[model samples]
Target: MTLELQGIGVSRGIAIGRAHILFHNQPDVREYLIPAFSIEQEVERLLDAIEQAKQQLKSIRNHIPANAPADVTSFIDTHILMLNDSSLTKVPVDMIRQRRCNAEWALQLQRDALINVFNEMDDPYLRTRRDDVDHVVNRIHRILADQEVADHEIADGRLKGHIIIAEDLTPADTVLMQHQGIAAFVTEHGGATSHTTILARSLGIPAIVGVESVRRYVQDNEPLIIDGEAGIMIAGADESTLKEYQQRRIAFDEHISSLSRYKSQPTRTRDGKTITLLANAELPEDITTISNAGAQGIGLYRTEFLYMNRLAPPEEEEQLAAYRDVVEGMNNQPVTIRTFDLGADKTVDGGRHLTQTVVTNPALGLRAIRLCLTQPAMFRTQLRAILRASAYGKIKIMFPMISTMHELLQARNLLEQCKLELDKEGMEYDRQVEIGAMIEIPASAVCAEMFARHVDFLSIGTNDLIQYTLAIDRIDDTVNYLYDPLHPAVLRLIHMTLEAGRKFNVPVSMCGEMAGDPRYTRLLLAMGLEHFSMHPNALLEIKQIINETDLSLLPANTLSIMEVSDALEADMLLEQINAPIIIKICLSFGFLIRTDKRILII
Candidate 1:
């Protein structure tokens, strides 16, 4: 009998083939003391394992095709650097000698310590780096434990034309699979924003993630079919099922190809209303994709990365260099840089310990602008760097998580101090740099008019706004289902912020997951949102929707959607108003649209 499974479909497409399982079990290392006489031998053994892991990473980096994409090579090179870095290799060796423990045990301890530091971080992108540390050390663990290191690339003649199944895949694993001619891949864990899924989309591979226990449910070599568009997986598929997916696979491919044509078109609604679509970025590597996606600007350049994965916070020069690279790349497009939003769960490496003792709930504790206001020195450092970089091109500064007028005043005061210092130092920066505030907190959203008077623009961070307004933790899967963006309370907050921006004549934008999603495109536009910032992958698709949409047809529909009390009812109203537009899109692209579920599969 066929066993069907559901997961979050991240990369869209379809795949049908035999299963190729990649077993990557964490090393089980129990702490035990070795004889003093064996201590030197253990240290040497640890060093040898480190050398072997370095060699393995070097080989993987070498295997990256000469003609492969720049990102693939960049990911492999990063792993090789980690293997050779003193922090990883040298630190573990020191632990082995000092603790008088086995090599596996020593490395395991170091991994935990490093992960602990990363876990306390507030940036989601930096938090995910803990997985990278795990993958690199797992390579050494395999060598130390005398376990076979499975081949990652498919060129070694293991399972050709097979769908890879794993508990989770790192960026390196995804890149290697692309080179291996793997048909598709399924993972038990990951999200749409994960680097693994991003790589899969870049490589144009079908992938499903967050399917718990998929690896254990299927035997090796079992025939499997993956519908990435629908997030469905069928094990031991029947002939009829296989035939249905084959047709879908073709249509999905054609639809994706058609989207590329929008790369050069302006994003304007059918009623001739121009829309500004910008890219939300975390890393410097993401900037190229932003331009490739034809974004008008970088809406949100998350600066938390400048404070992560290091012994201390990035120096002003270091931050300036990174910001400059993005500025030069955008070629006059506006780049809004948010201040280092540390505290909460995200802690800085070399910066001040703002939260010494763990707060029972860090989310409500010192974070974002609150932490920055309390620690003006740290805030000044970032402000100076951002001001210095602004001279290079169009740059704007945005403060995150501002909950009160006092916090905003304190932050602006320090920013002025940074500008004075820069002027004293004879540095060149744009004196007219635009300042903006992120209206995420309910308190701030309610008082947006007060904020608009002080800043040049307002960008609604809907992700946090919805989470806070609905009293749900977005990261907590249990309560995540209750996180509604369409709820009446959430809509009122958004509407209030936008209306305030309009009253003050300040540009209002949204830089959140909701802004990137096509499902809410018409709803947001009707609510008077003209600026949207999202992941680069969705830029073209959202633009396609914007270009075909007539803003004149949406206000009444949006009013009706907001008045509904039931969440499901609101969703149905949105689909009813939006479905015709989607259908037109599907017909234009010559693809079938299946609305059997929340996801519109083409």
Candidate 2:
């Protein structure tokens, strides 16, 4: 009999292949007392395990295909950094010495302590980081128990052209499986915002996650079909069901092909309002996607990747070459490169040497502009490189996590110094390069007018803004339900920032996940935002939404909707305004019609 399953689809595509189940059961690490003298030996064993895990992560990272996206490297680097973190390294060693416990027991104790802190976190994104810690500890435990870690032998020509079914896959596990030509993956755990899912999306693989008991219901070599768009999985699928899905997949392909025609079309609403759609890039390979997606420019170029997965800070030449490639690749499109957003749990490339202290809560600790200001030499090198690259094309510099006027002034003063140094060296570069700040923290959002007066532009990074405003992590499943983008407070902050940008005559753009989603397109456009930057994959859908919208028709309803105090009511109001045939309004221009089944046509 054919059995169907439902899960949260994180990526879009389809595949039909034999199931290859990988067990991810937690290892049993029994607590047993060791002699005081053997404590030294146990500690050595633990350190060895940590070192071994780091080597494996590096090997996996190195194995990633050259054509793979930049974020894949970042995901692997994050795990490797965790292995090097004191909580995982020194804490377990101390536990072994102080508790006189075996290596496995001591590691588990430290893992629990770290996870407990994460569990108590108010943010959903940080709370899910507990899984990263869990995956690292499991790797070490496997080494301590002398067991073969899963995917250790994946390169031996085993897992090819199959659908991977697992309890859960770490980012490293996903990268390895991808290298082996795996068709798709189904996991029993993980939410849409998890790093694992993000990697899958970046790899363009079909994946479904959070399917409870999916591993138990399926077996190795079982024939299966995965519909990533519909979040449906079929085990031993019948011929009729397969045929139906096959046609749907063809239709999806056709729809994508149709979207390409609009690639060269201008992004204008029905009333002739033009919106600048930009791409958020982190890697050089991303420029191709951005150009293909017809983005007006690169709005947010995260520069942290240059400083990650290395032993030292990027030199001026190295940084210059990287930035120059992106600027040149985008042709004449403007590229706004954000400075290193490291610190917190995102430490990488021996950056701990720069900070020299472990941050208890990385979110509020030394990171972004704070870290840059604290390390002026390294910061100066980056500024010179960015300034040098600006001479090649339209390039802008952006600072992240600025919460006060003082910090922005301090950063601007440093920029002036870098410009002076460049002039002394007789280098020619763009002296009028635009500067921008990310409005993420509530204080910055509330004081957006102050920032607008000083900067050329302001970009809203709603990922952090919502997390900080609601005290909810977007990744934690426990409280993820409360992660509301439509919350009144979040909207108010956005409105204030937009109003300030208008009053000060500065461009305001949103470059977060919310910017990519089409659901909020009308609301944001009605709010007077003229620019949006998002992942390349979502650019087409948003463009479709923009073509059919009339900004004039939305002001009254959008204002009324924003005034609603309750989220549910506000949500209802938005739906009412977004309905396809509201008030039987006749249309002079093309309109998008979405049925109850959500099949869309424009």
Candidate 3:
């Protein structure tokens, strides 16, 4: 019997191979206990475990030669820093002493403190570092245990030559990914830049995610085909089906060879219009991927990730070093950094929520630009840091989730105050840094023209823009199906956003999931959108759409395209394309023939 699976495309490519299962399970605190003979023995146990962990990491870190690249060294340093950090080690050791609990129990108790911090941070970038902590804990767990047990070890004989599925995975688990390894990874949670995605991409594997019920659907050793590029799932395939893909698989390799030619070429449309191809990155490790993918700049540099893994906020000096690394790595290319957008949904030491107050709806709760305003001191610290880094490179600061004038005004005011303080210190700063607002909210979309006056440019975040505009929490399991970026309402706001931007003569760009999707790329380009920022993996496909786009007929296509009733029409329009397809066919031939136009996907 054949089976099919589907998932989001992270790094683009094609592969057809047998399943390679990677078992990733949470560390059982029960496993780390050592007989407590005395305080001396307990410390020795921990010290020994810590040492073993150091060696295992050093071995993995040294797998690549020393002269490989700076990024490789930094990746190893990340694990090293986490392993030696006092945040996880000190608190847990203190707990073991105070409570006289076993080391395993001590680890469990101390782990909560670290987990609490990660759960509270609203920044996705920072929130992602939770994986690093998990990595460290897992590393230590393996070191302290008597048996060399991990769910799946690549070097193990049983590990290679099978497809793997898990609830979730960490980077440490994925470190086992060797070249010509990791057939695929399917999990209940993750996006393109997820830990599993990174490992799979590095190993060039096909994967699917958010399958909703992957564990139930998949039987152990069930034959399956995971299509990474098309995001298709094909159950047992007939010989012809397999052969068709085989030819395409070979074509994919040839296609890859062709892309190398454009790796150094400027991204230009067939008409010779140039478009800046860039990457939306949060981690410093991501910067190299962007550069290697031949991206021109870093379009969205989410700063929250730096603060997520640790106990306290990063020091000013640490922040400076991070920014310098990113900017200097870009070699004068632009890096637009978005300030931290934290709220009740994302709590911190300085967070305004009543201590530990839990809110039901975090998306609508205080977050992004609003959180910064509530805590001006915290806000000023970030602003001051960005301005200080301005002298180092071409940095553009953008605020996320700005819904009203007051938020933008007060944020600007805080920025101005920081500028003065920097002035007094005789620090070199970008005297006039470009400021922008993410047009994610409905009110902001309609009022974008007014916003452009106060800001240098507008980058529409369609992911949240669609959600807030439609009053849908796309994350809500009940409404997840309603997350539509191609709905007419979404398009109009985009149209309005672009129109408003044009009126103000400010550059308008979209840095969202919608921008990266190939199907929507042409539709967006026809909607008068020129600037796009998306995942590093999406640049080539989106650019291909841009090159093949029939921009001439988009104005006429608008009426028919908008007439399609719903997302399915939009889906069909996207999935199929002719060499010189008319934009109008996409608009009219969609499945939205009968639905009401005003109803939103949410």
Candidate of highest lDDT:
2
Model 1, 29-59: lDDT tens digits are 7888878899889888877887887786676
lDDT of 2: 0.82
Q: Residue-wise lDDT of candidate 2 within 321-385, one digit each (tens)?
A: 99999999999889999988766445354323355565577677777888888888888999999
Instruction: Report the candidate with higher lDDT, 1 versus 2.
Output: 2
- After superposition, the stretches of candidate 2 with alpha carbons farther than 4 Å from their true spots are 1-8, 13-20, 24-163, 171-183, 191-195, 211-250, 344-360, 553-556, 581-602
- Candidate 3, residue 79: lDDT: 77
Q: Can you rank all candidates by lDDT, best first?
A: 2, 1, 3
| Backbone clashes in model 2, listed as residue pairs | 123-473, 124-472, 124-473, 125-473, 125-474, 344-362
Runs in model 3 deviating more than 4 A are 7-11, 24-40, 64-79, 112-135, 142-145, 149-162, 188-193, 212-223, 344-360, 470-479, 553-555, 558-563, 575-602
Candidate order, TM-score descending: 1, 3, 2
RMSD of each: 2.7, 5.8, 5.8
TM-score of 2: 0.76
Between which residue pairs do clashes occur in model 1? Answer: 120-345, 121-345, 121-346, 121-347, 122-346, 312-350
- Give per-model TM-scores: 0.92, 0.76, 0.84
